[model samples]
Target: MSMKHLKYCPELNQITGSINATILLLQLEYWFAKMTGGKFYKFLDSCEHELYKQGDSWVEELGFSKQEFRTAFSKIGKVYTSKKAFKESKDLFNGKYYASYYDRIKGLTYYIRNDAKLSELFDDDSNKILYSEEKSTENTEDVLRTPQIIIPANPKTSSPLSVEYNKLLTSVKDTHPTKVCVPYETIKALFNQYCPSYPQLTLLTAKRKTLLKKLWYDMGQTLENFKQAFLSAENSDFLSGRLGSWRASFDWLIQEDKFVALLEGCYTNNRRQSQFSPSTPSAPKPHSKFTTMYSHYWDFEELEKLEDQYIDRQIAKYSTMSVALD
Candidate 1:
């Protein structure tokens, strides 16, 4: 199935998870509209884009009158803007003016081009804004030229991971018969995301079951805490196998003392200390051809700075050579 990139702010769900269903839909619609048409459409006078049309005609196309559109936008905007999570995070709306439009187009195009059967939570039918074939045929060529974006079809059925997760959840509840049960898939997804370099381990394993039970039940740590602790372990040079063959694994994460230490930020703080302090003299370890070295902490900004310095040096060297030739 094809992937149409949608302008999704994941933090929106996090911030507004408890909001009313109708209000949630209103927010989504506003986000979709803002994504298709530029936010500058709100102030038509200053919009420099050639594709931007004058007046309420553009707004009308979104199935909302001027007043209704404004109200919808305002209501959702207030909900999100008031949220600390939303305020702390950045999204398409935070960057360039045209970001929302492009994101909406990509997201729309994804569903249109891909298979249907998306999850009920994010069904494609809910996003039926436009891009019908009859009109699409006429506007296909110009659609690319214009500011408009194609809203893709939704394949809002069950995904393999979701099915597996749900199945696991039901099984766990049945077997344990407990009042408290952690969502395995959520924690698994978080681990995969935050610790990409680590080996992909499944919670369905016997060892993993024990580990998760310890973290979730025995410790009473929330999913968020587990995620942070996982990140901490991943960032540790010693624990992640950077310094030696001894590296922490999924099973190691649940060790009673180790897990408690990680939760207390001891591991993360130690890693930070190592980064800032001068390296101490130590015995050199044997290195094999297969022993791959990775950065202890890779920072994008640091890499960018190094890249800029390299580019400047190249430019200066080239200028000197040109002068010599002259």
Candidate 2:
């Protein structure tokens, strides 16, 4: 029989004390099974290891959110930095062997435990264990034969660790929809270059990160769009603090409504007015009433002249009709 599905052991939950960790362990076992030359004692030396990248497609394939995956992966045990020290027998786990090692450049590698309690679950012999589909519908006990543990009538109250674990699990279960990946540092750099006068973004807090990710996704997920947004802010008189004391900052620019307005040229400079002009200024010219409304495009003075001519023609036609009637 071909090993098509992963067999889950209830003992893993007992060992890890978490359902998320149990699921991750099963998935990791599935991956390890695919490695060539068979499983061995030490990680990166005896057995082949897989490098797990965060936010990879396999994470979703295993039905885990990013946060859930991270939490579950951490529960496995300490991740060693040095491969030499990790290979040493003294550094290995004493009783139940479960180790993880991480490198900054290469990424994360795991070593699943191969203890007697869970040995049968990881066995190469596929026919020994019954898959869910092959199991008899009458009883599930045949498929999962978990050893019964005697519990006291009055179990001890939950510990702080258990409470915190429960909270983490709750957060994992309540996962938000995956966000579009945004180049946050690149955007920050662009903001710094373009809006030099505005408040600089030194620290990217959790709230700011959330806002930026949302903005990047909403704004079509392009660096060029971000560039244009920054440029628009740079050219704006009000936003650049030329028109007012209050100036636009990174926080103000990322707001959806405000960003949309900025792109629509709402806050842009109306004319090419200089910031610092001569003390002797030119006399102000009289402008049409509609000047403020159409100042960006139309010549309101010409519009006023056209209106006067139309009124004159209408008056002349009415007088000519009255004279003919008389």
Candidate 3:
């Protein structure tokens, strides 16, 4: 039987415990090589590291329906053990063989296991010869070439990301690369300690992780910078719900715009004087000259009585003059 297009070892399916998983792994390896310009390995910080792909794209390209793709994708990390004496124990497996990080907005990023059992499968001399032949036939029409062999390095002890991203130090010269790994747990602790009034972060969800990573890269990529940002948030009365109903949350504080505004002291209390403060009572205006000259004669109540009596006399005189005329 001639298997021309896609050549994969049967052992791959056996080890991964699913034919779909084997196909998915091979496909990922093929794309990783293409994305990295024929290189077997590339660090996440490299310019060409935007390897996030939507699941639908994978489904369309791989000719698998959404359900099949999801099932295969989930099984990429699992490693099945060999058949045991008992049939019931045959399906048991050890730790995960891959590490993946899923950002709801950015899609999925994955790394293969760097252990010996999987490495031997790719590093075989036969596999290399097959890969060379595939590379030579690059111009062939409709020919899906076998993927290049990727020999990943031993897994790293300390993971930069969460437990999900453990064991991904793949074939780099520096085993401990100096990438700005976001210490999510430590930052969460700092946020809880400093911004006590804000909502406590019980779970580091995918959305929160995405925001935290963006913030770590955008602002200074250091724990101290994060600490300072949290401290600033703590000091802001507006962020603590003292000045307004809205309070700053872990998510809100780590947002790019809000975090920048916080570091710039935009929300800091300026302690301006209140608008309702009592003003100094103005001095009474000096008495006008006319009032001062006639101050003694100016009796408001007595003048009113005199004016009424004069009006009464005028009325009686007018009455007598009318009687004479008649």
Best by lDDT: 2
- Residues 1-326, model 1: lDDT tens digits: 43221222222334334222223233344444445311222321223444445532324233333333333333333222112222233441231111111111111110010011112234454345321223344433223211122222133633333555446423522433246576777877776666654677665676676667656864545787787777777666667665666877777776755776676555652222332211222213326523434355778678656744553454345445545654
| lDDT against the true structure, each candidate | 0.42, 0.52, 0.50
- Indicate whether candidate 2 or candidate 3 has the larger TM-score: 2
Q: Residues 273-325, candidate 2: write the lDDT tens digits.
A: 43322231221322542342343577767865674455345434544554565
Clashes of each: 20, 0, 1
> Could you tell me the C-alpha RMSD of candidate 2 in Å?
28.6
Poorly placed runs, candidate 1 (over 4 Å): 1-179, 269-326
The weakest ten consecutive residues by lDDT in model 2 span 145-154
Per-residue lDDT of candidate 3, residues 235-326 (tens digit): 66567665545776777777776886676556655544222111212112224423322234577567645643543343344434544554
Model 3: which ten-residue window has the lowest total lDDT? 79-88
TM-score of each: 0.29, 0.32, 0.30
Clashing pairs in 3: 153-171
Better of 1 and 3 by lDDT: 3
Output the lDDT of residue 131, model 2: 23
